[model samples]
Target chain A: MNKHKQVVLDRNKVLSQIQRLAEVAKTDNWQYEYDAQLDELVYGKDFMPRDSFLFNVNGEINLFISPDSSVSGIHIEYFQANYLAHNQELQPALRAITKKTIKNQRDNEAATALEIELSADAFKSLFSKDQLITVL
Target chain B: MPEQEHILKCRDCEGKLVIFHRHNYDIHKKKHPELEDTAFFPDRVRNALKYPTFTIPGNGNSVTCYYVEEFSINGIIKYTKVVLMNKPYIMANEKIHHIMTAHKVGHVQEEKYPGLKKQMYHNGNKI
Candidate 1:
């Protein structure tokens, strides 16, 4: 075979090997942010224990927590609300009320403000993978 | 003790982010009837607040929760962005979320190296 033809064949063979390896790896993922992190910067710690009450879907409290409800060394009872509400269907308002409880705290103000700013940003987050839905 | 301030991290040099993990920090509490009894983790993010010149959906909705953290593991650093969304729950499209995550990581990278995002915006990721 001609030297030029031989070189072309070798290049083709190398390319074929690369293609096979690519299929084996099969991890072509676009880079984005991770999800576990939101809490790190926002809450600035792992989930802690706190005082909380479980409210109902109709906006009524299933049971009220004591005035001094926080228990030390717990996940900080942050908010015992619904995670599925963001999915759809009118949430009992418990989540909103619970969230309201945390809104604008002196310590959280900085984190909340940052989150609010990012929310308005033109760029998207890596963890916004979950499907978004509006409730009636 | 808990968190410091906010800064950026780079995805290229470092890696991905850890995200939303609230650990050791100064704690503050609230006990208002309206606000209820809630706790604060301080400026937990301490390092992810740059990327100024921001904007939200003109459609009229506010964000409730979000945070991104970049750290190293096994000599590889990664970026993570946690979002606890509320209103306007339904996003415009699917790929849009991925774009946003990439953008947030972009924010982390910009935070690490000043002017990176703006430079990328202008130069278009030549690297």
Candidate 2:
């Protein structure tokens, strides 16, 4: 068929694989939530084959899956990079600092928690790439 | 047949090395399942962030599973002479390929969803 059609089929195949992988991961508690097509929303119009679906994992991290690997390819960006890079400088949660490091501060603690969980590469990939390809 | 003719002439080209095949893996399955076997992409992207060039299997002869079709486009500029294949590739059957095409289009659907595209591009700081 056409390239677009082929992309759609490929996405489904990837999803099926994800489903299998998720099951294999066997997380004690995991839920899958369907999201509106994000690709069309980005491309401005929808055509044959449809677009990638969205997912909110555990109320955090909106995981996107689609054939437009260009933009969709997860490359983290923004504070995520700084976070991953700077996370090492912070004193361990169980360690002692100047009676007051940013981690000890309530506001900074919350921000640090989120930052700690991400990697430099993944964080950049998430936002830097351009979203390419759109389906019906 | 369609590719054989193309291969014959390229075989005699005196310029750069003429590569006629490729190999890769199944990102989803890990199995390097044999490809259709045929000629594939002309260049390779060695970056981890990049997706990769496809590998369409060869023909009845020494064809490799290296996909050799697919172009790039960005409005005013359209590069059709190039093949959008992948490296360290994976086996994408017709069925799997179809699913992929549809899923990508789904992303296109998102572009039309209200101000979604605007929001995503501007880092959601705008919309």
Candidate 3:
């Protein structure tokens, strides 16, 4: 006869990972910004806590997962020159937003969302990596 | 008591470095308990700014990222500190160069952003 030890799993950790995946999948009402100075793009929902661990998805892209087990945010460094500058459609749209054409902050946010919608292929290229490598 | 304004200055740019109680101090304490020791906290930050191992451009125009490597029982750990040229949260008319936050990035981050590795500098010399 063999005695087996009972195995217990961390429920909260599992739940948070699930929630982060769901949020990433949905991709709705995401607040985004393209910092022209740093040429970085960051977008996410909810507050990103201090305990968030960064998971590198690809060379220039990474995801932030909060301690609560939720996807806090994602950022793409060198957004303009690397990703958007080459593309004809995305280049102009992003330039317009950063150029301060949309004076209102709220309206600017809306414009950014619209630009992202138009450049789905461009943005998707950043997340083309299907495998999530644990860099942390 | 000395005001926060008189406490520190940015090593590279020579600008004043301000740490807010709410955004920086409290938040950092909660997130990075490893750096909670009051004795070495200020010295660590000051030295990090003075002699950073890596200096990456920040995510925003007004921000700058600094990384310093530390040796611990676990091994070489890197701490990242971000400073902003303008504190948007503050309602003050004057621009404030604020120390936003500091946290450990571990060794893995160096592997993740290879481009940043190429730009690493030690004591103002490229390593």
Task: Using lDDT, give the best candidate's number.
Answer: 3
Task: Order the candidates by lDDT, highest first.
Answer: 3, 2, 1
Candidate 3's C-alpha runs over 4 A off are A1-29, A67-69, A86-88, A92-136, B1-45, B56-65, B70-127
Candidate 3 lDDT over residue span B6-125, tens digit each: 334444433444453443465445434434555446676676666677766554335556667654332323354544444333324434456655545543333334454324777756
Candidate 1 lDDT over A1-136, as tens digits, reads 3211100112232223223322312232111111222211111112222433211111111111222321111111112122222323323223332343435454345333333332222013212223211110
- Candidate 2 chain B, run of 10 with poorest lDDT: B96-105
List model 3 lDDT by residue over A39-116, tens digit each. 656555434555565443444555555434355556555576555644545554564455534676766565555444
Model 3 lDDT on a 0 to 1 scale: 0.49
Reproduced native contacts, each prediction? 0.00, 0.00, 0.07
What digit string (tens of lDDT, one per residue) describes model 2 on residues B71-104?
4333211111111112212233211010111011
Residue A73 of model 1: what lDDT?
16
Task: Compute the lDDT of residue A33 as modeled in candidate 2.
Answer: 15
Cα RMSD (angstroms) for every candidate in the order listed: 22.4, 17.9, 9.3
Clashes of each: 50, 93, 1
lDDT tens digits by residue: candidate 2, A1-136 = 4342223224333333333432322332221111111111111011111233332122123234444431121111112222223556432322321123343465356433332342232334333434323232
lDDT of 2 at B108: 20
Residue B16, candidate 1: Cα error in Å is: 26
